[model samples]
Target: MTEGLPMAVPAQGLPPRVRIHEVGARDGLQNEKAVVPTEVKAEFIHRLAHAGLTTIEATSFVRPEWVPQLADAERLFPMLADLGGAPDIELPVLVPNGRGLDRAIALGARRIAVFGSATESFAKANLNRTVDESLAMFEPVVARARDDRMWVRGYLSMCFGDPWEGPVPIHQVVRVAKALRDMGCDELSLGDTIGVATPGHVQTLLAELNEEGVPTDVLAVHFHDTYGQALANTLAALQHGVTTVDASAGGLGGCPYAKSATGNLATEDLVWMLDGLGIETGVDLGRLVATSGWLAERLGRPSPSRTVRALSHKE
Candidate 1:
């Protein structure tokens, strides 16, 4: 395929623009089997910002032993301190607990995310705590973040399905999402960690969240493409008025704790769809593809993004 833009065809009732929460530096890299060098990771984030991804998730403040790939969070965050212009780019970091929150706050992190789970299995596997226990742990963290006047994002994983458990109920997801929103999260990224969600499931969950007083304005959708449903699920969320969508640069990352999970929705692919639909993301497609290509080269693997494959000639 040629290195070109997609045809513009506007979609009805969709938002004029979408805020892509780029997660390649954090979520994508953390799942890597090998530890990526800190210098290289910093360069990747810089490239992502240069590619016009305004809100890039810089790194996770989780314990080093828990996610070895992102062990250089302290060293990496400073490298991106000057990654912007007119509208300074937003760099959000993930914090697993109060200790993690302390680490981030010390680094002058203005935005932080607290990760939770919709199911007991994922909560136990990822956080080593029960669902209620994890929420209790996050309460203090979220409260502290809010007190500091920082933007807090709540990531509720396994919203659609859990590998250990089967299909997840919508009400169960809503219960957890409501709890997170009620706990003072500025935004909530509903995660389909195992990628078992369909469009119908996505819409149903969003509706349930709305009914439970979790408005669509503060909602984001994070979908994995394990069963080729991420894009479809994202479109469903868009139709339901969700504007913030989380995606990895090149379909990079899966749940480190869930074996059945696959890569996230590719930023390039998402941009391609939004571009074709005449929706604005402010991302330069060619530049974004090249950035993913550069990261793919450093990792010694081709990008999983179809748009990247079609637009970039790998060496």
Candidate 2:
């Protein structure tokens, strides 16, 4: 088990350790217009693991036509098979359905994730099905994955607000989350797909979920920085007993289905804040910054992480 800092009571009752689920390799690069080379993707994941990120989301098994950038998932998984030898490290692939799950299982993947949407508009636009239909699609996938003893995660997008549907109600978000949880997902990540969530909104949604008997132990938060509220909302979730957060390296991802959405919270930025609070994440800040800087060259732009920019003198 990863040891955290000595427990210090904060006024907000936050946990001493926070698990930063690194999503840069998959989520961050998925929306990029240019295709990143498969070898580069492998190197990036290796660097992230070296930076002390234990749970790195490596690639998605979606159809190439949908996400051409990650079309090399099959090629990339084999390159990462060596890293899985470390008991502390996990490389999870995003599997859209049973076919995607089959591709991952054939490559020896032990962890996989399924995605759903909270709002009807996003559900239809992204998955080409209604919210219930998407959940139905995930049921068999999650069941088969668990039967194989592979860890399964379910993601609920647009939990706070939606672009086409306007403000999403707390009840609606809870309903989808409950269904995902009941489907045998080991964890459920609530996403601010368009990044319109505020601290108050996060608190309200979490509180309601808690009332509905969804324990925080099985929950994670995935926030986007579109409105500059990602960190603040994360702090709110932490205070509410959420210990897992999903962040991208260098603040690299945006939802392609939501044009108005911006990048996801940067792992470097999240680490900086958690370090300041004396919360342990077992990640090396300096090395994480360097990794982002290295990726920036391939991306042809400076990293969006303020911590990386500040430390690199790019400010």
Candidate 3:
């Protein structure tokens, strides 16, 4: 947690803290057609930190061929390593495999995330492997990360729907999530990659997971705004006691594979909704909006955050 920020304990006694993982640097910049300059990426990260976002996904360690935009991770992470007068924040990079992990570790990454999709077809298409094969690949990587004493987060993409296989089976999602949890992931982020999840779908899955005794503490929600349901789905997850939700600054991301999807839930929008519900996020709304505006300008487009738009208009 970022220190010195005042805690917001809800008057109604809601859990006083929720983890908001900022993925704008990696996930947000990954899908961009135009290469975001290394200096620009660095400044974006600095603004995010000043906005009180404690956990920011700094970059990805994948091969340049896979994601050319983040090819600069090697350099970007090193520059950010010296930020905030001692790197007080948690900066996690996405590592696709052992090679990616090696690059991330070389860049002094203390934390990393691995990607996996729940549906077999989706996994094969996105990761070029079956669901089981994907898990198998992560086993060694997770072991190595644990040996290094680094925090590992598992990303389960297409948790709700898939382009090739629509409406993923509940059992399939549960099986994969349980496998990742058993593999020693500190957190499992269930992604609505295509943004097809509803509040009911979220509740149903959580209910089933609860019955199976999967700890909700290790769960996080990652939602896209395809059908404009990301915020609604996030609210449902919050009701189920899921305290961690992934959001991108300015909604600056989308699936390069999943068509018609917008991006991760906008951080400003998510924070605004949480604040209205009297939930605690430890994020300054004005600073967050400013950061979003700055990034939106960098991207040369308008921010997709409705809350940001409304607040800025009022001001």
Candidate 4:
């Protein structure tokens, strides 16, 4: 399909609203070669809140030795803790295991994210464990978060395919997702880790999950734009009743393990599509674009978002 192709969006009368989890501040900038200042990260998140993003993945509480970019997770949270940008906004941090979860909780994090891979090799490369082992590691973390009354979101990576082990099995993805949900995760995000998913692949997976009686309400979709199919795959998810979508503003993230993977779907483009569908994201498209452009300039590169480029040219 061509860029910005208009399609038949579901009627506005649909019962549920799609919730977008904006991850530009953390995931997008983490892959950047240059270091983004903590203050700038805070401002970026503040602007996103102003644009009506209620759920934002704020930062990662991982070791500096691995991802030095988000080493300021502790410092960043406290700085924005009192900003009061949005009344019920959710700021989640990526917490791999006990150590990361501890740091997140120490910083007063109310929400923590745990991600596991569908493919064993990708799991090993990304988290240094097998798929089962990775899920097992989260057992304690999820329990602790539940005890503290904190929100926990689980991410199943390589749901569609893996760079190391291509064409991930649908059963594997479903298994990991079910495991996370069983462990008391509030939501499970199925990721197209290498951006190899097509609308058909997405529909098939959704159907399989539906057949298994998975709770659609607790499911989300995370797509990358590697083959220019992120939005298409998102539309497929919407058709399957998935209302929670994850995107990075300005198209700012990439998979370090998946060499050909592009950034996450652009929030600008996703908002544009949802707006045409009369979906209520409560996000102001113009302000979101402006903030994305500002960061793109700061990073000294053009944005990967088709909507951003088109809108910028129009201006």
Model 1, 21-133: lDDT tens digits are 99988999999999999999989988888898899999999898999898888999888878733266999899999899989989989999999999998898889999999
Stretches off by above 4 angstroms in model 2 are: 1-12
Error of 4 at 190 (Å): 0.4
Assess the local accuracy of residue 172 in candidate 3 as a C-alpha lDDT between 0 and 100: 87
**Which candidate tops lDDT?**
2
lDDT of 4 by residue, 1-315 (tens): 223334536564443467899989988988999889998899899889888898989999989988989988878898788643446798988998999998988878888899888889988988889889998899999999999999899998899988767788898888777788889999889899889999999988888877776777888999999999999999888888889999999999998777778899999999989877867788888889889998898889999898899888867
By TM-score, rank the candidates, best first: 1, 2, 4, 3
TM accuracy, model 3? 0.93
Query: How close is every model to the real structure, measured as TM-score?
Result: 0.97, 0.96, 0.93, 0.94
Question: Which residue pairs overlap in candidate 2's backbone?
Answer: none
lDDT of 2 at 162: 95
Give a tens-digit lDDT track for model 3, residues 1-315.
Answer: 123122433545345578899998889989999999999999999888888888999998888988899999877887886662455688998998999999988777888899998988778777899999999999999999999999999999988898888889998899999898889899999999989999999989988887777888888999999899999898888878899999998888998877766788999888877776667677888898888887778788888888777767766
Candidate 2 per-residue lDDT over residues 81-169, each given as its tens digit: 88988899999999999999999999999999999999999999999999999999999999999999999999999999999999999
State each model's C-alpha RMSD to the native.
1.6, 3.3, 3.6, 2.9
Give me the displacement of residue 33 in model 2, in angstroms: 0.6
Model 2 clash tally, residue pairs: 0
Displacement of residue 278 (Cα, Å) in model 4 is: 0.7
The residue pairs that clash in candidate 4, if any, are 28-252
* lDDT (Cα, 0-100) at 176 in candidate 1: 88
